[model samples]
Target: MCANKKANDDSLIVAIRDLNTHGQGVGVIENDPSGDCQGMICFVDGALPGERISGTLRERKRNYLIVTLDQVLEPSLDRIDSDCRYFPECGSCRLRHLNYPAELAVKEKHVRDLLSRNGLLGHDSPVFKQIMGMKDPLHYRGKSIFPVTSDPAGSGLLIGQYRYGSHDLVDLHDCHIQSRPALALVNRIRELASRDQVTAYDERTHDGTLRHLLIRTGFSSQEIMVVFVVNDRQADEAITSWLPLLKDTIKPLGFALQSSWINDMDTRGNRILSSKYRHLDGSQTIEEIINGVTYRISPDSFFQVNPRQAAVLFDEVIRAAELQPGERVLDLYSGVGAISLQFASAGKELVPPLEVTGVDRVKQAVMDARANAKINELVNLSFIEADATEWLKDYEDNAENQPFDIIVVDPPRKGLDPKALDVLRESGTPEIIYVSCNPATLARDLALLSDVYGIESVQPIDMFPRTTHVETVVLMSRNG
Candidate 1:
């Protein structure tokens, strides 16, 4: 294929050697006749490692180019047919085309390669355990937010995921990873919105009612919450009128419509849900029980999407912490205090119960976390509303607050900031367990913390299977 193409041709053929952080297959362009674009790295979507693929040039960066896969000249043995109808288009699940084992292998190798590149994976390093995958990876996502937009033809509403790196909606009917009830509820909302003429919010014109539809389901309680992100206040009346109809539509689906909310996201940015919320019906929050610890999830709370795997992940965090009686634990970015509640529940029987403090910047999450702690009767836990880094710096300054024996951080995808890292380094906490969703940021932060804290053990959990994303729990301890 390469020999026949003109030197100036946009078509390029390359053999994929590895997967990038975004799960895109990576290859190097070499021996090109043009020699202009030669030696430049190529990232091809839908191309698997050990496969020869031909792709059209989509974009060119300083050192690399992104190609849209046109044909797999030689498919890898690990490649498998995608089960989802919206595999490449939806852009939600990037690894659904590969077999489950092969997907896990690819993710594990990515983590190892990144850590090694960051100088954290080597001899005398932490024990790297095998990646923990799911027996049933499909429909594992307990939460889903489908973007709502108007169709190009201007006929009806289009509700689904945005295409990869684009604003185009895929008009999804079903999803392999999202909850069935959630999808159904969103579909029902689309139908009602169409009938009621509730126009989909347009970012360009900023004219419309519904912007997004967010649905969250409790795996254990089987309760579902529907939140409508709308631009106008008038949408409240239209959405509230559909409550009974929504309940009627969802009850037959064997899931309770426990909560309904309208979030006013009238801004111009790409944010999906806003801080403004108005309760429409049912409870203010839905409950999810993980390992006997109950969590009240608000509309904006940052609970794990995979509830089943969350139990396993939380168990690993608690186990890695090796909590002792009377020891204090600080949980930073503790959304809804799920992990803190688990920590308190696990150590409630100790003579001096573990003093666990949960800190989060989101007021709603902190409220939910405090309510969750009270509901679980975990007396040793306290949920504070504050920024994690600021709290850490304040703790360092005050010295009046008892120093924590263990600190667990579950920051967002960007990982810990520099100030947080500096505080952790100077805090001299005995044990620190970092729960991370992004492997690249995790490796970077771990490398920064390597001077004071040695990586004890690294466990990669498949929180989002069939996707390139992996949840990692790393145990780090103060170096001698």
Candidate 2:
């Protein structure tokens, strides 16, 4: 069929072979000669593996073609009806159509494939452990951001996610993954903004005022923080009038309004928060207790969205470390020192006291990390505001800081910096724990370090369920 079909065929029948990292089904055309797409791969949206789909070619690029699913000729038995109304359009949860167990299987397979492709793991490697899935995955997100725009047909404001791969925002009434208190707070803010005639930001022409509504909730404390991302440096006249009312109005909604802040972002791009922030009302930070440690989250700090799964992920990291007394630990890209604080607390009772040092590029996060250490009364930890790559390179040269007993790196999705990886490979640390959110990047890094370090095990945690994202923790020991 692929050989017979033309580039502009009315419908192309695709038998999905596998899924890509973005949850898109991947298939290949064999001996296709219509437009030189022979042996070219194609990605189909809304198509699951082991299913025959009827789709039309939307975009035909040189490397691959994008297919829009028209009909599922054969659906998999694992497919289930999506509970959320905005299944494919919202693009928030890519695996919402599959059942929980099926989704977990797909994620695990994807991770395994990525690792195998990079030659980091064998097909039946014992080092690759079974994925740790969630028992209850609904409404696990503690943080959500609603981009503000205007309704094209009406005068009301529109607040929700932008359509997948497009700038057009889809107005959402409720979300399955977001917390109830966060959604409720969004509705109340939208109601007030609509009544006050506050303008919504237009990304097309860079017009309007309000850009985004950020709501963060503390699961254990039930405290909420409301942040208004606007386009002006100063507080908008409209926001100054109505934002104060939100402080008194949120208590009845069953969540305490811990704080409210306004972020001035006048840039033209899609960046949500800016460096400039102004505190309007209430306390500056909200607290979340995880693994007997209380973390103070600032308005601009980076914290895990799923609080419950964060504890699970942290526990797995501690178990993997197997620290000894008086051992020195280094945490790279340690935002707000969440993992560093845990290491310090774990060694608080050990003889000579284990020392932990956290390094991050963000100045505010370093500030928060120092403040958090003071808040928890843990003095054996130190925070350094420096680029992780530069810090690692510098540590290698510094005679005093060389030869750390244990090194933990929780790098960004792009994975370890190349220089950082080179330094890590030569550091000769006894133990290294890498926590990564991107499987592809993790595999790439692991392959590079395979010769110098032996990978002990890989534990995949379902941090963001119903989404294609998975958090993995790998323990590696330096080869003698």
Candidate 3:
């Protein structure tokens, strides 16, 4: 049921029948006394499936809404006690109250429903693999960002996530989803911000100093980067003095500053105050090993959040491709060469050599991809920085080499760009593997591509638990 539903004059209590993707309890209003057959749909927070709740009417932009959870009449058998102190407050993991196995099953069902809705699944379609859970749900996040805000009633600062349904910041001393080191650093930063009397940014006045605290860590190396975002360059003195102390305290490999001035008139603007940054030992790279191939990661490069599941996903791709020796493989949207490097390394162990071409729009990512190839000593692999659609157009026009034997596309959440789909349809690449994070978009793209490509199989991998997100890898071949 949709979250936003029109409200009628007469409202009544309703029981939540199930949980939706956004962590809201969904239910249908019964027996419209007003003689309107349209049953009311409501979304209530803090209420579980099979529970009855009393709702209050609230008005929201052309729609009167039922917005309050009065009570829980019944609880589902799946509901368990949340382990973290900030279970629902943290707003990071919504399904922590559910068992791990149940969470996986629900995620798989979501993917299947999406695919079936778009007519991409059929009785003869290949079996959908079971959802893959993370090795450790807690402390799995390698990166986290905290916004700095001032307490309106006081003169000190607070550091943490934004409050639910509002921009207000909530000070969080501990978050179970983040790595232990990250949580530790958050506490340290909060204490330092309070002690130094550093003013947190106030959007209403644009007077406070600090804006945000960004932290990223490499799991393999334990290398860390801390970036302090501020509203103006005038706070350089405070930042400079604090950097040394933070360096000694947190021991991060890199320290940087980014400044943006917030102007009044109820709008937003951003301007980088300091383009310069400092790094310990003058290195800004993180080492990540995927499928036994190590790659260097930079500040803005895209890497899978769940590294272990990423390996499993890539392995599924390789198996689906049935990659033969000496086959020419094209890896599109290959950020930092993770998938390309994995396939190239695997080919070396086989009897024949495999040639790979990796393409991405980000120049830095392409450079890193090439660097990874060099480090792995992959002689037959090459990297190119170009728009995936444009490059595919040019590749089709040139037609210098044999048609690509296998094409792998791991697009962003928006799924493949329409122009890329057009090129793929025209190129007639014998085999295609499409990896996507959003099942709805994947289903839409698959429906479009099914006209020319036959769906061979689909494997859904649970890279994210506790959240409604899922990753799917689909294999298709040219239709006869």
Candidate 4:
């Protein structure tokens, strides 16, 4: 009822006070203390803070209102021209309108705000360090997944991201942020699918064969893995039959040199790929070296997208660890054992050898990590297939696996689990190196671990440069 009422009365001319987590401009009505509606915020998509905008409500939630900008009465100095032709519509790059320096500044401010709001920021608290940004922000992504669907007229293959807040697929000829070669591969695949009369998946009807195309590029090795997400088992045979023709077509388009191919059966939910993959051609896994450690990466591996920035991020982690020889290190959510292998490999030069163990829930990733450990010749490192929290419980019960000298965690966007933090507190680990992609979750996790840990250093790395996303690494020592 309230949502409907606000929908009728959404016209307002207000100045944007700040930006929300999604980087949308938020404006609150002036001189309305108890007023949330008349004084309620109007969230404009293209508007920036300190700018007066004339907008009407596009949507209304339970607490606030989402406004669409009709006209900007004034523009902020921070605003800039978006280079991407598909900006504000493609939903892939949100910060493209803002200059790179302004983007970095806003990100740092957001991290600080998250930390301060969660009671983790103060002069005596964690020292908010400088953010590490990319030298050249464009074309940094090594991974690009294009949704394959029919055009609005239901004619040909439309490949790109969905329109903002809608499942309407849009075609993109050039993506400035993604790798150029990866984009080229997508174009060729679309052309081939159209030529071969391959069916594009329809979300509403749930009918069709080809669903999505996933491409992973090894930044250093220049190797590429192409995965075709299909509706059923028949799509594999269909794709296999067309491979020769596709090879002939894309050979001129520069796609013949791809390293591997896989058919990912995931016609269901939005998951990247199904667990089952049918390898079709070349080596199933390609190799990429980071920090001098070689890793065998599969089609569905969770390797870092920006390999160059990843090296800098890993360097910060190594420095923050202040690792010594013979220290026992525990790596949680250690996808492919990147951190674990790096620490173990570094121990070769240390006075006392390092012992590192990595734990993750993904069985395939664990297997890959074990294989990576052997291939890298890091005998000191080991991997276990289990939830990090569950493994911690077992370690807590057994006297053999008491406390670790150091622990490194790289959790998903949801951040660290509370039970996991509790175990870490009780485990008596002296130091924890937290690699985080979401700062909001990172702040919450820091607050939970505050009882046992003190923030030693905080460094933010620009992992996704053009987008609003940023990665942070925090080093926390046991509190006395």
Inter-residue clash pairs, candidate 3: none
Model 2, span 1-480: residue lDDT tens: 233345476566677888787889897643233545545678997888888777776787657788778898889888888898888888688888888888888888877888888667786789888899987898788788889999898767988888877788888879888887777767777787788778888878888888998888898888888889998643366676765576556666677888888998888996888988888778999998889888899887789899889999999999999988999999999999999999999999999999999999999899999999999999999999999879888878887865989999999899987888899997879999999999989999999888999899888899999888999999999988
- CA lDDT of 219 in candidate 2? 85
Q: What is the full ranking by lDDT, best candidate first? A: 1, 2, 4, 3
lDDT of 4 by residue, 1-480 (tens): 223234455456768987776778878744232244567756778877778887665678776777778787888788898888998889787777778887887788778888888667773354888888999887777778888888777677888987777877769888878876677777777776777778887767878878888877676776667788887655565667665654554455444435546665645677657777777877777777889988898887888888778888988998898888788999999988888888888786776788899999999899999999998888888899998998988898798866999999999999977788888888888999999999989999999988889988888888888677989999999988
Q: Between prediction 2 and prediction 4, which has the larger TM-score?
A: 2
lDDT for model 1 comes to 0.86
Range of the 10 consecutive residues with the lowest summed lDDT in candidate 4: 1-10
Give per-model TM-scores. 0.93, 0.93, 0.86, 0.91
Per-prediction tally of clashes = 0, 0, 0, 1
Cα misplacement distance, residue 222 of candidate 4 (Å): 0.7
| Residue 53 local lDDT, model 2 | 76
What is the model-wide C-alpha lDDT for candidate 4?
0.79
Off by over 4 Å in 2: 1-10, 28-40, 233-253, 400-402
Q: Write the per-residue lDDT of candidate 3 for residues 1-480, one digit (tens) a residue.
A: 213324544444666776677777777655334433235676777666676666554433233234566445566677788886766776677777777777777777777777887666852355676676777776666567687787777857778887666677777877766766666667776777777787777777777777776666666666555666676655556655665555455455342221111212212354422444434332566666777788776655677776656788888888888878889899999989989998898887666789899999988799989998998888888989999889988988886857789999999889888898999999868999998888888888999998899887878888777766778888889999
Number of colliding residue pairs in model 4: 1
